[model samples]
Target: MTIHLAVDDSVAVLTLEHGRGNTLDTATCRELVLKLEEAADGAKAAVLTGSGDMFSAGVDLLSIDAGGAAYVREFLPALSDALLAVFGFPHPLVAAVNGHAIAGGMVLAAGCDHRVAAAGPGRVGVTELLVGVPFPLAATEILRCAYGTNPLAALMYSGATLTIDDALARGLVDEVAAPEEVLGRARELAARLGELPAEAFAHTKAQLRQPYHERIAENRASDDVHVDRMWRSAESLANVKSYVDRVLKR
Candidate 1:
């Protein structure tokens, strides 16, 4: 299954479970969007967690290697759809990040109303560079919208995975808990948020989240260019993979 869900009174817990690392595949993305919509429609608050030992490995590398151009062409809007849906959800959304959470995985966690990470070396960042891919238009603005200007540059250039503490310091993550306690902590946050006045909470949330949405909308309204597809000699996925493999190995 792409996702797993459990309901507890006013709270809904969602899990990303799609392989060894919970990488966001096309199928997984679609499943998550549908599941989150279901959760948002009924639950007072929702908490999303990753399956197994990872928050997410980011995107499915094999998918990209097999269908890079088509994937990028379609991925922007699919991602935006999911993010906007979460940002506009009627109920509070919480992310109980367990580990890694790089690239698109980072996007998933950040889109939530609240973010909590398991305390460890598990990091947060947009690590597409390490995979020889680009964040595309919507994803970039989404990151900028959440973390603002300062955090954007660090994520883009450094591309270094920030520890959970660093993630909190950078305003990328909201709370930290022990690995085993992540779900419980997220449930607690969900329960607390559920107690707030839903009307006021939603209004305030709308006010806060729209800027990012607006930014993403603006970026997507036009066509932007990138070099990820260059060197196609024509382009060979193997060539790109070699570059990524070498970079990550370093």
Candidate 2:
């Protein structure tokens, strides 16, 4: 399984463990949705983190290059579904960003109610433009909600990865901790938030997020069409290939 769930003191910890980087692919995304659903059913709160030294390297770009346009068609929707599931999860959710969270990975972190990142070399940023893909509506909305439009616009446009300090300054993460303390800090926050009355917390969360949900609902159909088309285009595919080559060379 790409995601492993462990529950303690009514807090569910969902660890992304697909590979060295815990990259997100169609299957991984679907599994994340399922795991979050399971957490919601049984746990008062959830903490998301990644295995090894990375939160997530982001979308499985190598997989995308190999899968081609046909796969892109299937992957985009699943990605959106996964993002929505994380963003709309009723209970408290925290992110323990133990390492790098790039591109879609950063979006997932932003979707959480609160994010705590580890100190050290770990970097965070939105990099869809660098990967030659547009942000899915769900991703754009989530980041916009987390960082506001001005900062979000700058991050998206530059596709620049930021250090843990820069991330905190820009509001990408709420707290910073030592690498080893990241998960503990996240769990502490999750458990603390979980102690609140469930109904009240859920209600307040819904109210805060309601506008974004409505915005997504109204524009997703059209926005996704454009996003999917861009992702599947020959130019974008070529760009993905170049990116993969560059990374492989380094």
In terms of lDDT, which candidate is strongest?
2
Model 2 / residue 19 / CA error / Å: 2.2
Candidate 1 per-residue C-alpha lDDT over 14-107 given as tens digits, one digit per residue, 9 for 90 to 100: 9988777787777777777898888877788999889876888777765656676777555545655665665667788888998889887887
lDDT of 2: 0.93
Best by TM-score: 2
* Model 1 Cα shift for residue 149 (angstroms): 0.9
Displacement of the residue 78 alpha carbon in candidate 1, Å: 2.1
Candidate 2 lDDT by residue in tens digits, 93-187: 99999999999899889999999999999999988898788989998899888889987888899999999999998788998999989999999
What TM-score does each of the candidates earn? Answer: 0.87, 0.98
What are the clashing pairs of model 2? none
lDDT for every model? Answer: 0.75, 0.93
